[model samples]
Target: MYRVMRLIRRFEERSIELVHSGHIVGGIHPYIGQEAIAAGVCAALRDDDIITSTHRGHGHVLAKGADPIRMLAELTGRSTGLNGGRGGSMHAADFGKGIYGANGIVGAGGAIATGAAWARRNDGSDVVTVSFFGDGAVNQGVLLETFNLAALWRLPVLFVCENNGYATTLTVAQAVAGSITARAEAFGIPSVSVDGTDARAVYAAAQAAAARGRAGMGPSFIECTAYRFDAHHTWEHKARVRYRSDDEVAAGRSRDPLDVLGLADEVRDRVDAEIEALLAEAVAFALDSPAPDPAGALDHLYATGLRTRDGNGLLDSAVR
Candidate 1:
C-alpha cells in the first residue's frame, strides 16, 4: 500500500513537471495529498473488480494497476497512450484491468458504476464495482438517484467519496448542508467516514464495504476525508486561486500520507531510487512516442466501425 501511494505521489509530481515544461498539455489535477485513499481502496479490491474514476483520477488509475509509461504517454498526447492518446488525462482507461474510465463529468461515474454492478449481478458474478468521486458529486441528482437505485436493487457497488473539503473553490462546510454520510444513510445504504490520510483505516473500511457487496448485502458508502495539497487543477497554479489560507494548507500538509508508511531509512532510500528510475523511463517513453494522426481521429470513436454518411446520403469515402 505504501509503495502504491509513493508511486502515485511521484507520478503526479512528474506529471506536474511535464505540464510546466509543455510535455503534457492542458494541465492536470494533481493527486499529491489524496494518495492514501486510492491506494487503500484499490489495495482491497480484487483484480476483477471494476472501478469508475473522476476527473482527478490519475492516482486511482495507477493504484488499480495501469502502466505508468502508457498513462504518462496518454497525458502527453502520444500515440502510444493507453487510449491511443485520444482519452488523454481525463479519460485514460484500461478495460482489461477493470478500469472503466476517468470521467470528465462530476458525478456521472456513479450511474455508470451502478449499471455495471447490475449487469455483473445478472450474469451471476460476484464482481463488485466501485465509484470514486469528490464531495461536489454528493449534491448531484444523478448520483443521488444512483444511490437510490443501487440500494433498492441491492447491487454490489461501493461509492467511495474523496471529500477534500471543497467542491472546486466552495468549501464543504460552505456547500454541503448536513453530513456526507447522512446523504448515503438516507437511502438506507450502510456508510462510514474514514481518515483519508491513513491508508490502513481507508483499507479497513474498503475491505468491509467490499465484503458486504460480495456477500450480496448491497451497496456501501465510504467518505474519505483528506486534504488536497495542491491546486484543484494545474491551471490554478497559474491562476493563483486564493481560497485556502497558508496556515490551513500547512496544517493539512503536516498530516502527510507518506508519513504513515514508517519504513526504515535504508528501505525508503532504496524505494525512492527505484521509483525515480521507473519515472525516468516513463518520461522518456512519453516524449519519444509520436502524436496521433489527425486522419485517424475517428478510428476508435465507435465500436461497430460505422462510418458517417455524406451530405448527399452516400457513405463518406474517408479512411474510417
Candidate 2:
C-alpha cells in the first residue's frame, strides 16, 4: 500500500511537469494530495472487479493496475493512449482491466457503475464495482438516483466519495446542503465517513464495504474528508485563483499522504529510485509513439465499425 501511494504521488508530480512543458494538452485536474483515497480503495478491490472514476482520476487508474506508460500517453493524447488518443485525460480507460472510464461529468460514473454492478449480479458473477467521485458530486441528481437503484436492487457497488474540502473553487460546506451520509441513508444504503488523509483508515473502511457488498448487503457509501495540496487545474498557474489562503495551502501540504503511510526511510528511498526509472521509460514510450491519423479519427467511434461520411462529403486526409 505504501508503494502504491508513492507511485501515485510521483506520477502526479511528473504529470504536472508535463502539463507545464506542453506534453499534456488541455491541462489536468491534479490529484496531488488525494492519492491515499485511490490507493486504499483499489487495494481493497479484486483485479476482476470494476471501478469508475472522476475527472481527477489518474491516481485511481494507476492504483487499479493501469500501465503508467499507457496512462501518460493517454494524457499526452498519443495513439498509445488507452482510448487510442480519442478520450484523452478525462476519459482514459481500459475495460480489459475493469476500469470503465474516468468520466468528465460530475456524478455520471455512479449510474455507470451501478449498471455494471447490476449486469454482473444478473450474470451471476461475484465481481463487484466501485465508483469514485468528489464531494460536489453528492449534490448531483444522478448520484442520488443511482443510490436508490443500487440499494433497491441490492447491487454490489461501493461508492467512495473523496470529500477533499473543495469542489473546484467551492467549498463543501458552501455547496452541500445536507449531510452526505444522510443522502445514502435516505435510500436505505449503509454509509460511513473516514479520514481521507490516512491510507490505512480508508483501506479498512473500503475493505468492509466491499465485504458487505459481496455478501449481498447491497451498496455502501464512504465519505473521505481530505484536502488538495495543489490547485484544482493547471490553468490556475496562469489565472492565479485565490480561493484558498496561503496558510491553508501550507497546512494541507503538511499532511502528506506519503508520510502518513509510515514507510521506512530505506523503503521510501528505494521506491523513489524505482519510480524515477519507471517514469523515464514512460516518457520515452509516450514521445516515441506515433500520433493518430486524422483519416482514422473515428476508427473506434462505434463498436460495429460503421463509418459516417465526413461533413464535406469527402474522406478527410490522413494525418502526416
Candidate 3:
C-alpha cells in the first residue's frame, strides 16, 4: 500500500510535466494527497472486482492493475491507449479488469457501480463493485438514488468517498450540509468514516465491507477525511487560485500519507527505484506512440459494430 501511494504521487508529478510539455493535451486533476484512499480500498478488492472512478482517477486506474505505459498513452491520445485514446484522462476504461470507467461528471460512478454489481449478481457471479467519489457527490441526486437501489436489491457495491475537504475550490463545510455518511445510512446501507491518510485504516474498513458484501449484505459506505496537497487540477498552478490559508495547508500536509507507513530505508529505496524506472519507461512509451488517424474517427462510435453513413447513403470509408 505504501508503495502504491508513492507510485501514484510520482505518476501525478510526471503527468503534470507531460501536461506542460503538451504531450498530454489537457490538464489533469492531481491525485496527490488522496493516493492512500485508492491504494487502501483497492488492496481489499480482488483482481476481478469492478470499480468506477471519478475525474481525479489516475490513482484508481493504476491501483486496479492498469499498465502505466498504456494509461499514459491514453492520456496522450495514442491509438494504443486503454480506450483507444478516445476516453483520454476523464473516461479511461478497461472492461477486462472490471474497471467500468472514470467519469468526468460528478457523482456519476455510483449509478454505474450499482448497475454493474446488480448485473453481476444476476449473472450468478459474486463479483463486487466499488464506486469512488468526492464529498461533492453526497448532494447529487443520482448518487442518493443509487444508494436506495443498492440497498433495496442488496447490491454488492462499496461507496468510497474521498472527502478531501474541498469540491474543487469550495471547502466541504461550504458544500456539504449534513453528515456525508448519514446520506448513505438513510438508505439503510452500513457506513463508516475513517482517516483517509492512514492507508491501513482504510484497508481494514474496506475489508469488513467486502466481507459483508460477499455474505449477501447490502452496499456499504466509507467516508475518508483526507486533504489534497496540490491544486485541484494542474491548471490551478497557472490560474493561481488560492482558497485555503497557508496555515491550513501546512496543517494538512503535516500528516504525509507516503511517510506514514514508516517503511525501512532499504525497502523504501527499492520501491522508489523500481517506480522511477517504471515511470521513465511509461513516459518514453507514451511519447513514442503516434496519434490516431482522423479518417476512421467514427469507427468505434457504436458498440453494435454499425458504421455511420456519409452523404448519398454511402459509408464514410468511401471518402477515405
Candidate 4:
C-alpha cells in the first residue's frame, strides 16, 4: 500500500514538472495527497471489477494496472497513448483493465459505473463496479439518482468519495449542506467514513463494502477525508488562489502517508531507484512518440466506424 502511494506521489510530482515545462500541453489535477484513497480502494478490487475515475484520476488509473509509459504518452498527446492520444489527462482509459474512463464531469462516472454494473449483473455475473468522485458530486442530481437506482436494483457499485475538503476553491463546509454519509443512507445504501490518509483503513472499508456488493447487498458508500497537498490543478501554481492558508497546507502535509510505511533506508533507496528508472523510460517514450495526425482525427468518432459528411453531403476532407 505504501509502495503504491509512493509511486502515485512521485508520478504526480513528475506530471506537474512536465506541465510546467510545456512537455504536457494542458495542465493536470495533481493527485498528490489523495493517493492513499485510490491505492487503498484499488487494492481491494479484483482485476475484472470495473472502476470509473474523475478528472484528478491518474492515481486511480495507475493503481488499476495501466502501463505508466502509455499513460504518460497519453498525457503528452503521443500517438502511442492508451487512447491513441485522444483522451489525454482527464479521459485516459483502459477498457481491457476494466477502466471505463476518467471523465471530466463531476458525477457522470457514477451513472456510468452504475450502468456498467447493472449490465454485468444482467449478464449473470457477479462483477462489481466502483465509482470515484470528489465531494463536489454529492450535490449532483445524476449521482443521487444513481444512488437511488443502485440500491433499488441491488447493483454492485461502490461509490468512493475522495473528500479532500474542497471542491475546487469551494470548501466542503461552504458547499455541502447535509452530512455526506447521510446522503447515501437516505438511498438505503450502507455508508461509512474513513481516514483518507491511511491506505490500510480505506482498503479494509472498501473490502467490506465490495464483499457486501458481491453478496447481493446492493451499493455502498465510503467518504474518504483526505487533503490535497498541492493546488487543485497545475495551473494554480501560477494563479493567486488563496482559499487555503499556508498554515493549513503545512498541517495537511505534516500527515505524510509515507510515514506509515517506515521503510528502511536501503529499501526506500531501492524503491526510489526502480521508480526513477521506470519513469525515465516512460518519459523517453512519450517524448519520442509522434502526435496523432489531424487527418485521422475523426477516424473512430463512432462505434460502427461510421463516417460523417460535410455540408455538401460528401465525405469530410480528413476521411477523403
What lDDT does the true structure give each of the candidates? Answer: 0.94, 0.90, 0.91, 0.92
Stretches of candidate 3 off by over 4 Å are: 311-320
**Could you give candidate 1's per-residue lDDT for residues 1-320 as a string of tens digits?**
87888899999999999999999899998888999999999999999999999999999999999999999999999999999999888999999999999999999999999999999999999999999999999999999999999999999999999999888899999989999999999999999999999999999999999999999999999999999999999999899989999999999999999887577888877888899999999999999999999777657656767557555767677733
TM-score per model over all chains: 0.96, 0.96, 0.96, 0.96
Q: Give me the candidate number with maximum lDDT.
A: 1
Displacement of residue 71 (Cα, Å) in model 4 is 0.1
lDDT of 3 by residue, 120-147 (tens): 9999988889999999999999999999
Tens-digit lDDT track of model 2 for 244-296: 99999999889988888888899889988998899888888888888888889
Q: What are the per-residue Cα lDDT tens digits for candidate 4 across 1-320?
A: 77677788888888888999999987999999888899999999999999999999999999998998999999999999999999999999999999999999999999999999999999999989999999999999999999999999999999999999999999999999889999999999999999998888999999999999999999999999989999998888888688899999999998876775577888888888888888889889999999999878777877867668766779877667
Candidate that beats the other on lDDT, 1 or 2, i.e. the better one = 1
Using alpha carbons, what is the TM-score of model 4? Answer: 0.96
| lDDT of model 4 at position 90 | 100
How does candidate 4 score on lDDT? 0.92
* Candidate 2 least-lDDT 10 residues: 311-320
lDDT for residue 231 in candidate 4, whole number 0-100:
91
User: Which is superior by lDDT, 3 or 4?
Assistant: 4
> Ranking by lDDT, best first?
1, 4, 3, 2
